[model samples]
Target: MKAYRMLTEDEVLQLKSQSCLADDWNNVLVSSDFNTAYVHHTRFSGNVKLGSFDGEFTLKGGIKKHAGLRHVTLHNVTVGDCCCIENIQNYIANYEIGDHTFIENVDIILVDGLSKFGNGVEVAVLNETGGREVLINDKLSAHQAYILALYRHRPELINRIKEITDFYSNKHASDKGAIGSHVMIVNTGSIKNVRIGDYCYIEGTCRLKNGSINSNADAPVHIGYGVICEDFIISSGSHVDDGTMLSRCFVGQACQLGHNYSASDSLFFSNCQGENGEACAIFAGPFTVTHHKSTLLIAGMFSFMNAGSGSNQSNHMYKLGPIHQGTLERGAKTTSDSYILWPARVGAFSLVMGRHVNHADTSNLPFSYLIEQGNTTYLVPGVNLRSVGTIRDAQKWPKRDKRKDPNKLDYINYNLLSPYTIQKMFKGREILKELKRVSGETSEIYSFQSAKIKNSSLNKGIGFYEIAIQKFLGNSIIKRLEGVDFKSCEEIRARLKPDTEIGLGEWVDVSGLIAPKSEVDKLLDGIENGDINRLDEMNTSFETMHQNYYTYEWTWAYNKIQEFYKLNSDEITVQDIINIVNQWKEAVIGLDKMVYADAKKEFSLSSMTGFGADGSREEKEQDFEQVRGVFESNPFVTAVLKHIDDKTVLGNELINRIGHLA
Candidate 1:
């Protein structure tokens, strides 16, 4: 609400004397504090408004420059107070520059006609051949895009989401662009139809067109040298630097894409890091990191994934266009030089090694490994449940989150064993038991989904899945009865009952948020029926689900307890609870011992081969200890031992408490 008035005749003359020219002096309006002494060597046209330039800016080396317009051309622009606009190679047109900003050595910044600032751009993510186009807007979240891309079967729901996005885009369409306060745009080229936010730093960027940098004071964005971006919306706390190129993309909060990484028609959600890699039409969910120069991720949907060096995927068989796509569920990892033919689905927390041509689907067998030998795909199920690397990955993801914005777009769940993976393990156990029953228990190998599982692996998988299931269910029961003072068997049974029925049946991982499938369906129904019309309301619904996760999880676990233990909820007694608690104690101790054993392999003799080069065996052992620490004293090993001790005490305490009720 700044007031502007025409400059006095003497002020106009003084400005002219200071080497400033205007098409018509009457068209230029200035604030009360505007001084002719600070305005020099500038040309003004097309109804320009100038604010007070009464302050000076201090440089890094204690140099001071008075805030004013110098050696620049402005057309239909309003320059705010304390801003220094200097050395513009071409005119800045139709922009409202904010206070305390510095724009120097820029070429041609403008808003042409009416622009939506990339709000309505359709990003063809997940499937490269199109159809799964998420209309990316400023408020787009990973969970929203997940539904839009993969829930194509619900056409009405898709149309509703598109309508909401289109409405948002149209509402924000403007004829004039804006640069917020405290922004610095230096040595940039051709910024057209872009809206830059507060505290943003843009330096040496080649071109940025039709985008919105949603930066703020709390979480500023930095776009650095040689970066070229088009039709994108980069959220707060992100850094795009070092010759990176992106087109038709929506980068979420705290993401980093740099070092010549190139992406086209993709959606990268929160905390995703891509350095020196190329991605095309991929839906990179939260924490999908690819740091290799030779790795190419295309036509895939991934979350909490890590792609190793030289890892690649094929999107076509060469007969048709590149129409195939694949999904690697959360926490899946690919080893170096690994390859997977598209139209496949790898389960959650699975490790992939070598190359495989067959389209194997291991969605029911999580925490496993898919290794290739002599071109044959071998499935080792539930082995990753005991891997030290898997535990470390689970422990590190939450610590690695870099989003500083208070309003995070993506809702991430960091639990390694939730209802989502536990359900898969439950099905995996059933599938293994069925295989053993059908193939005479003595079969050499069992074939499933074009992959082979040896008899030993199958039996071991059953045992592993059972242990994990017991652990999860036991955890739920113990937590449910944590502070309850149940003195009788009836009170224990009453306490064991679920509070709600919302978590029965199946659950899904919507990007990172894990919730019941029934609830997700209800949300989709609301969207389809026009009950949920705004983007904010949809995000609010997701937040509600995230907030009530434990409540819903207890319901699912309650139902599974009855089925797994063959008990009726009303007729259950304290003796049944004690038996379940005893089994849980054994499961917890068994898994911890397995993890301890797996961690010991890292310090084995074979792992010390490359250590202590140019030394004898004793020296090699010494060097390995110096570099990697002793096996008994390593941090992860200590944590594992502590976990074992804590869980053992917890199980015994719970068992003793339940025994008193009997």
Candidate 2:
């Protein structure tokens, strides 16, 4: 870390003779031992400084380039020695170039005026009509944006957030830009008013203006050919390449945007991926992915969602502009060609299929399906609980986290069944019962939330939700009992009791982090009171909530169990516990068997059609076996079998432990 020093009269004379002109030669500064030999074929104007760059850089393809100035013009710039800067079509101005930086074949790199590198840029996310604008910054998190965009009813809080962002922007505003050490910029077009960080690699990029590439040695950013970015802040470990266009956006850590993806007025949080798709006014939370060309996500807020090919949403009716915004809670998915009208809310882990025009709202029914059949929106609630895809998604999310940076901005929870969805199940069960009571028990179709639920489906949904609740509560109890040798029933009851009252009410997923509603409200109250002012403080709250999720969940689950089984936990006997364990064992095994059956569908005759194209019956069978493998040997199938075995053994063990009291 060398400190900049003032230039002496003799060195200023030599620089003047070298055709470097400054407003005042005294304004041009240098390090104490700046070398005059490194400044060559470069014209400097305005106040400038120079540093000793005594270093060599090797290009990606083994092209050796020395550090020195050549064929460039600078204004109010500081050029370090041992840096190779050449062929700038326009002048490089108001910049401090760091040592050993390799710059070649760039059209221009300049700070035209005072700028903050895209901070405080208002991104009209979720609603294009602009009521919910998120102030973009280098450190913006999904939770902060969620509050700013969705909590407009609290105008004072929103104003406070806006003021905080404005303060950050003003504090960061500077007339001079900075390019960090070991940066490589080659074959890039105009780069104006953007700050480049250390070890960044920019090649063949088209226009980049009013942005900050927050790259570093630990997590460098790579901007590749034909990309055009404006009004953006790209975070560390991200790759923006292959003709992608971004405007008014923040690409968070370890995200991938390439293959002609275009985004505007959107905020993509940690580990998101967008390729060959278009997103507008979307708040894409962690792991929100759209990789198909036909997928167009607009005016929606989502997290941990996978948009299938041809998935589209309609935000505007003919009367109004695209003012409507929708929310698909975490782990939601849309099938191919599925369409959702905005102003709708779909629940977590639910699947949307077909073009639904009924404007259905199923936020209380997680793990369900909204399917349009013959223009009728049919709801199959809670059926997704046994789906193999749902299980696989839960199993894969933690392993697939793309963020490798040590300093993760967003704290993500990947649980499929948290208090968030479990509370929804409680509501879903009640909703189904209310539907059954209002309609005749024998009615063929019952209507709820703009969707039709058949008599059988409604009853089955209630059953499914109950089973899921049992499983979750059973899991919580077993976990609480783990490593504990309970000698008395009172001790067992104490161990199973919740540690906190926070989990007694509903829960919500703040993007990828799931927590109790009371906890989220506490965070909101803190924000309103200006207690949580910084982004780091907000994220810390979310992390704290995530870490305490299980404690809160037990509170909720313990209260629900008395209502579910008609036996209060304080009065529950050993026989009651045995009954609950037996029910849980059945539910777990039944769900696993359903999943196994569903996975077997992949090996059916219909699934083998394309695999054995040119083969006879025996050959086709052999080909299918060779390519798809036997269903019995599939990894998921084996896991399902193991799960059944493990659950049975555990249930028997628990039953025997309480058998004496029984």
Candidate 2 wrong stretches, greater than 4 Å: 4-26, 79-82, 656-662
Q: Per-candidate TM vs. native? A: 0.98, 0.95
Worst 10 residues of 2 by lDDT: 19-28
Tell me the deviation in Å of residue 300 in model 2: 1.2
Residue 199 CA error for candidate 2 (Å)? 2.2
Q: What is the C-alpha RMSD of each candidate to the true structure, in Å?
A: 1.4, 2.2
Q: Which residue pairs in candidate 1 collide?
A: none
The most accurate candidate by lDDT is: 1
Please give the lDDT score at residue 235 for candidate 1: 99
Q: Which stretches of candidate 1 lie over 4 Å from their true place?
A: 60-63
lDDT of 2 by residue, 1-662 (tens): 76777777787678667765566766667787777766666776788777775766777789776677767887888776567888888889899887678899899899987999999999999888899999988778777888898889999889888887888888889999999987889999999999999889999999999999999888999999999999999999999999999999999999999999999999999889999999999999999999999999999999989999999998999787898889898889999999998889998899999988877789999898999999888999999998999999999888888776787788788877777788889899999998888887999999996899988888989988988888887776666666656688887777777777778777777777777778888888887898977766777888788778777777887887777789777887777778888888988988889899989898889888877678688888999999878889999899999999999998888878767766
